[model samples]
Target chain A: MQITTFSFKRLLIYPVILIILLVLGFTVTAEKQPAWFQQAQDEAEQDGYKLITAHEMKALYESGENFTIIDVRPEYEFREGHILHANSLEFDLGDKLELKSDKQAALIGLLGSDKKQTIIFYCRSVA
Target chain B: MGYQNVLRFPDGFFGWKSFFSDNTQSVDTIKKLGIGDVFPSCRLVMLYDETDRAYLKIQSLQKSFALEDIGNPYLYIVIYNEKCLACVDEVQSFKALYKSLNESLYLSDKVKLLAIGAGSKKRGVIAFKKENAIPYPLFADENRSIFYCLGNPVLPTSYLVHIQPDGRRQILFVQQDHINNVEMLIQKIYSLVKDMELPK
Candidate 1:
C-alpha cells in the first residue's frame, strides 16, 4: 500500500480544523461570564447589602457589636475553620452560586428568622 | 429579601490571626513579653526542594530539619504567608534593608534572619518566592499546626529572638502587622536588641 504525502496532509487537516474550532469555542465561552452574576450583584445591592473589610469586622467584634455572620462556604470548610460565631450555609453547587429551588425557602427562613438582626455573608476571599 | 446592614471580613481567619492573639496571649501580651517570658517553639513543615521536604523544628530561636540535625540559631524569625499582600512588600523591604546594611552592624553575622511562610502549600509559596526573588530561606507551613501551636494571632509578625551566652532564649522585640519601612524596622530592632543588652 502506497501512502502519498498528499493523503497524509489531508488526514492532518481534520485534527487542525478540530483544534481551530475548539479554540474559537473556548474563547467565546471564556469571554462570557455567567449571566446570573451581574443579576445577583444587582439584587444584593437592591436588597441593601453593604461590603465590609475584615479589619472593620475585627474592630466591630472587638467593640462587642451585635451582627450575624453567615459563612457561605461549604460545610466541610466551615467545620475546618471559620469566623468565630459565624453561621454556615452552602450557597454553591460545583462552581456556580445557584440558589437551588429547595434551598431558597431555607434561605428565606434564615433571613426572616431575625427581623432586627444585621446579616453579613462571608467567604474565604471576595472576588 | 432585604437586610438592615452587611459587612465582610475580607482578610478572614488569617487576617484575624495577624490582628489579635489567642487566649494564651491577648492584645496586651506584648507589654508582658519581656526577658523572662519564654517563647513557645514548635516543629513546622517547610518545603526545601522539589521532592525533598522536612519538618523545621523551631525552638529557642534555633531551626533544624531533623531531630538529630544541628539547629541553626537565628537572631530573628519572620512569619508570613503569600496570602498577605503586605507580607510580600515586607519581605522585599527586608531584602533591601539586608543589602543596604551589608557593611553595617544590622546585617552582620550577629543578626541571622529566617523567613517562614505560614499556612501555605509548598508549590504556591515556591512560585511566590521565585517571583519576589526573596534573598532569605523560605519555609512553608502547609498545615497551620505551627500557627495554632504559637497561639493564633496576627500574621506577618516578626520576632527578634536572642539566644544568650548562657543558652537562654528570650524575645527582644515583636513587630505586628505590615511594616512600611524596612530601614526603620531594622533600626527599631537594633535599638531593642541594644536595650536588652543594657544593664539596668
Candidate 2:
C-alpha cells in the first residue's frame, strides 16, 4: 500500500513540473519583447496609427485638419491644462492599462471600438 | 487641411524658445560668470521624491562629495531629481559621465555640477532612485527657475557656465545625454573665459 501511494505522488510530479516550465517560458518571452510603448511603431504597422509630438498637434490644429487627438494624461492633469476638445484616452505608460472602467468605456465611445482610425497619442511627453 | 513639410522646426519658434519667457534670470543680470572665477554661493535645491532610488543615489553623491572648504575655488553641484524614472543601467551610466568629466576637465574649485529634476508624475518627488549616481553638490528647484533661467530642460543633462568676475553668468556648455563628451565641456568653459577676458 505504501508503494502504491508513493507511486501516485510521483505520477503527479511530472505534469506540475511541465506546467511550471510553460508558464515561466511564456513570461520570459514577454519580458524580452521590450515595453509596450516602445513597440508603438510596430503596433502602428499592425494598425495604421502614428505617434506624434506636442508641436505636431499644434501645427495640425493650425492647419484645421481633422485627426483624433487622444490625451493620455491623468484626469487631474488633463483638467489643469490640455488641448481643447481633446479626448482623454489615458493608457498605461508601457502600454499603460486604463484604471477606470468608465474612462475605458468613454474612450471606446469616443474613438469607436473599431480598430482602425487615425489615432494619435500625445501627452506632456511620449513615454 | 493644408499640410506643411513635417520635420525640424526650421529654426522657428518652438519649445526651446518658450522656456525663455519664464522670466527667471536675464543675461544682463550678472557679468556672465567666467572661468577662473570662484564658484557662486548659490544654494542647492531639488524637487526630489522621497521614495526615489535614483534620487537617493544622487543624494548619496551629494552627501559623500559635499565639501565646505574646497575653499578658494569651487563650483556648485545641483541635481534636479524631478523626473528620474530611468532604467538601472541608464542611471549607472551617469556616474561614468561624471567621472569622465571630472578626470578630463582638470576640474578644480572652478566647476560646479548641478542637476535639476525635470519631470514628475507626482506632486513633490517626480524623480526616482537609480543604480549609481554622481558625486557632487545637488540643489533642488521646484518651480524650475534655474531651468528657465538657463533654458535647458532636457533630461539627464549637465551644464557648464562661467560666473564672471563681476557676477554675470554665461552658459559655456549643456549636455543632453551621455552622448556629450566632457572634454568638450572644458573647452567651451575655457573659451567663454577667454572671451570674457578672464585669466584661464
Best-performing candidate as measured by DockQ: 1
Q: Candidate 2 chain A — worst ten consecutive residues by lDDT sum?
A: A90-99
Q: Is the docking of candidate 2 incorrect, acceptable, medium or high quality?
A: incorrect
Q: Extract clashing residue pairs from model 1.
A: A54-B9, A54-B10, B17-B153, B17-B154, B18-B153, B18-B154, B18-B155, B19-B154
Q: What is the TM-score of chain B in candidate 1?
A: 0.63
Q: Each model's TM-score?
A: 0.50, 0.43
lDDT of 1 by residue, B100-168 (tens): 544455446456566677777878778877888876556676776655544444456767777665555
The alpha-carbon root-mean-square deviation between model 1 and the true structure, to one decimal in Å, is 18.0
The interface root-mean-square deviation of each model, in the order shown, is: 8.4, 11.8
Residue-level error in angstroms, candidate 2, position A76 = 16
Q: What is every candidate's C-alpha DockQ against the true complex, given to 2 decimals? A: 0.15, 0.02
lDDT of 1 by residue, A1-127 (tens): 2569878988999999999999999999767544434554575577566555555676777888777777775454465566777777765432244567767776776667565676777664422
Which docking class does model 1 fall in? incorrect
lDDT of 2 by residue, A1-127 (tens): 9999999999999999999999999999768543544565565456444445435546765687666655564443354444555566555434443347665667667766445445555544323
